[model samples]
Target: MGEPLTIHLPDPESAIHLAGPGEENLKLLSKQTGASLVLRGQDLLVSGPEGAVNLCRRLIEALAYLWGQGRSVTSVDILTARHALDTNRTEEFQALQQDVLARTRKGEVIRAKTFRQRQYVQAVRNHDLTFCIGPAGTGKTFLAAVLAVQALQANQYERLILTRPAVEAGERLGFLPGDLQQKVDPYLRPLYDALHELMDPEKIPALMERGVIEVAPLAYMRGRTLSNAFIILDEAQNTTPPQMKMVLTRLGFKSRMVVTGDVTQTDLPEHQASGLSVAQKILHGVEGIAFCQLGRADVVRHPLVQRIVTAYEGHE
Candidate 1:
């Protein structure tokens, strides 16, 4: 129906990377542009209506830009690429390329995957106290953990402190396994998982033994002055106002704190108020503090997880 065009890639060897495994990236590009893509030698043939072909060309160039920057192309990357073009954020997207936060165990870059996430990262970096409230799978805890480890590794902070309220086991905290540490271990497993992802697994034991990385229950934080540390309070919604106040007051000099949670998932009783909810209202306009809210659109987990979050949000 329209003219076909052959666009040759400058680095032809990157075609496979751009196209993804089994030509999946091409499939995604076709879905997005409604253009038929054919890979021939170093050139990709685009066959479709003229507008679609033109859009496809732009997408290929965007993909080329990321690949040229040595970043892997994923389906989410394709979606971000489309969003960038539709919203005229292509240049801003290019700037995001240089903001690598940390790397995972497999050396995968852990930068912000979306514009909103980039804002959260900026807030964490600029503010001494930050609160990120979002649904599950939104990278609220994970990103904070990544930045915490990065700061600790860079010696910006002398230690890393992670804590979360044990809401599910409210009065049963002492009824669990051996000792206090073992009793709360299950509740703090998520923090451990994050640490293992960002820091070396073998090195964690020694670091924890030396108190460089401390993962403990929120109860352990009372009456302690945590200074020169990067502290993260996950699952803050389960905390009460008094607990939040106490922990926040413990923040000492030269320290940064990030509190992350989902108020919607608060397990508190009907008459009880969520500490994070109260903190959101009280600490919002305070200087040196930031609060970032992310929604279902920011969920970076599996596609179905996003859909599930959207469905629950709608039903509510």
Candidate 2:
């Protein structure tokens, strides 16, 4: 065992901020680094084997950017810090802390919470077309929507179109409800939910009416050249090869498209191939197109959600 390290905080209040709510962040740091941690007054005591102590020290340093500024730390912050230390990408990790993607209507700051998520954001920014494949709760759809909204608000794009394959409802909406939107809304609720998080819910109707924002089933994209738009195709795994090709071809001048899905959770028939999978195989090395694959580690939801994803992966 090495000598215990005593790190002094800027203030007593900052201890609680660094420790996280109920000290969950400290607990996760201890678990990840095998270090003993205790907060007393204004000092943090870390004691363990040499390697573990050093890791804990480095992780705390990496997270200093957040807590030092009085921002509350989260489990996602802890996991990301540990990952940055493990992969020797501490500089990139610090850079991510400064890269806020967007703020919610309620004033919550949104940023990439993992290395892969950062890469995904860069991919969306640098490429005209980007594909992200990941499990649930990895912010695959949310991040895309956030960027899309930011670009739309900045006038970078004339319109924002969010679409997904309505495979569950089979796109047979004529029998369902009132208007075209009301009929299609059941399958498009997730996209709506994402928009609501990024902008005023009350303003969404006005935006939709003015064609500044459009949320619809993937089928609605056919034969239309989507120009000057930022488009997000969510739940893309439900799309067949043809549908995927149709949408890819619809990307018109000055338009950007982000396609996100979890291939493992496809609702397609066993014999049918997921468009996402097929696209990955075919468009992988194509120029001006970027593909990002996020694993269970990229999950930024409740920590339990990461464990649940792992458990299901093991069972599968």
Candidate 3:
């Protein structure tokens, strides 16, 4: 171990925030940087190799920056700080810490956890149309829905539309048991789940009734111009070429569209080509549209899910 180093944090309030609840932040910082840290009053005693000590101090400073901004520092912040420290790129880390995508009912934040995710969110914010392609566990649909809800809540858009290709329906909408709405509701459950993450589940029905929020099967989108709306097309890989063309054309004036899908997970028959795959080729240089491809590193689910995606990707 290197010689002991003492760093005193000036403010008690910031010390609390930097340390996190039950010193979880300190523990994470120590573990992540390979430095042994112990808090004594407002002073932190760090003992490790010189390199490890420097890393710990940098992480502590990063946490202080976030805490000063009233942002909750968690284990995830440690990861971001370490990445920033390693790459010597602190700007993205600072932005990621401050990017408040959405807050859940219990006040948990839902910001981008990775650097690429921050870029993805920025793409969604700046582009009129964006294509997010990634595997499971990436925040493609969820982040798009969060932005859609925030835009609707801020009155940036008059409506929030969520739709997906119900490939399983297979032109049998009438034959599917319940009324038009009920039959398609099952297919759009992912959108419902996303909405519930941003707002109260009870409030969604009233919004849907008022036409402010529309979650429906992709079939209902035909021949309808969606104006002044934030629309998300999930499961685009399941859409046929005609279906993708129809939906893309439905984006009317003052509307933004986000198409999200994992091309590798296409459910279409072996003979059928996924519209998402085809659209990427046709619209490669299209103006006003952006495509963001996220790899296994972008998977924000459980750590094991990231490994699973990476393993599968390696095989491919």
Candidate 4:
């Protein structure tokens, strides 16, 4: 092992932010870089093999932009910082650190927290149609919803349309209680949850009534030309090939579409195929389209979620 290296944080506040609550962020740094870290006051001492120590130092430097801004460090930030270092995209990573996509109703700022997520957001901004396929908790649908709402509030689009295939609601929808909406509401709860995070719950119904925002099952999307709107199709992995084709063809003038799904969690029957998978194969090199694939490293939920995804991937 080489001599220990000591880095001084700007202040106690910066030190705390970098260390994270319960020193979890420090633990993550050691785990990731194979270094030993001990924070004493404002000094962070790292000791290990020369290569590991140097890498740990570089990772910390890459994350300086965030902690320098007094922002709290998170697992996502650490993962993205390492990714930026690995890919030599530290300059782009610094740019992304300053871009806030939107703020939540609770006043939390929302931004891309991983390398692939930033790419996905940029893809959505630059392309008319973008598809993001990843495992759960990677912020695929949530980030799309955020961008769609931002476009709507800015008057970039006249309406916002959210749709997904209600896989179990095909023929059994009529047998359920209430009206068509009530029957489909269960299938659309996740989309509603995302909307509620950005919009006030009481105001959402009014928006729906005025047609400013529409949420419906994929079956209701047939025979319609959607224009002047931002459209999102979530849970797309459950859609059949024909259903996917119908929705893709519905895109009209002055509109944008985001398709998000977890291909591994498809609810389709064993004999059926996932439209998301088919579309990826068919439209990969097509112009005016973008496809982003996120992996376990992109998950921004609880840190344990990343481990769970890795475990499942290994089993598969």
TM-score against truth, every candidate: 0.91, 0.95, 0.85, 0.93
lDDT of 3 by residue, 131-196 (tens): 999999888999999899999999999999999988877757888898888989888888888888
| Number of the predicted model whose lDDT against the real structure is largest | 4
Tens-place lDDT digits, model 2, residues 1-316 = 9999999999866798899878888898999999999998889999999899998999899999888877778888888888778788889989999898888888878999888999999999999999999999999999999999999989999999999988887767777879988888888888888899988899999999999999989998999999999999999999999999999999999999999999999998899999999999999899999999999999988889999999999999
- Cα deviation at 236, candidate 2, in Å, is 0.4
Worst 10 residues of 3 by lDDT: 68-77
Order of models, best lDDT first: 4, 2, 1, 3
Candidate 2 wrongly placed segments (more than 4 Å): none
Ranking by TM-score: 2, 4, 1, 3
lDDT at position 147, candidate 2: 92
Off by over 4 Å in 3: 6-32, 36-45, 67-76, 168-176
Candidate 4, residue 315: Cα displacement in angstroms equals 1.3
* lDDT digits (tens) for residues 87-177 of candidate 4: 8999988888888999899988799988789999999999999999999999999999999999999999999999989896664688889
The lDDT for every candidate, in the order shown, is: 0.88, 0.92, 0.87, 0.93
- lDDT score, candidate 2: 0.92
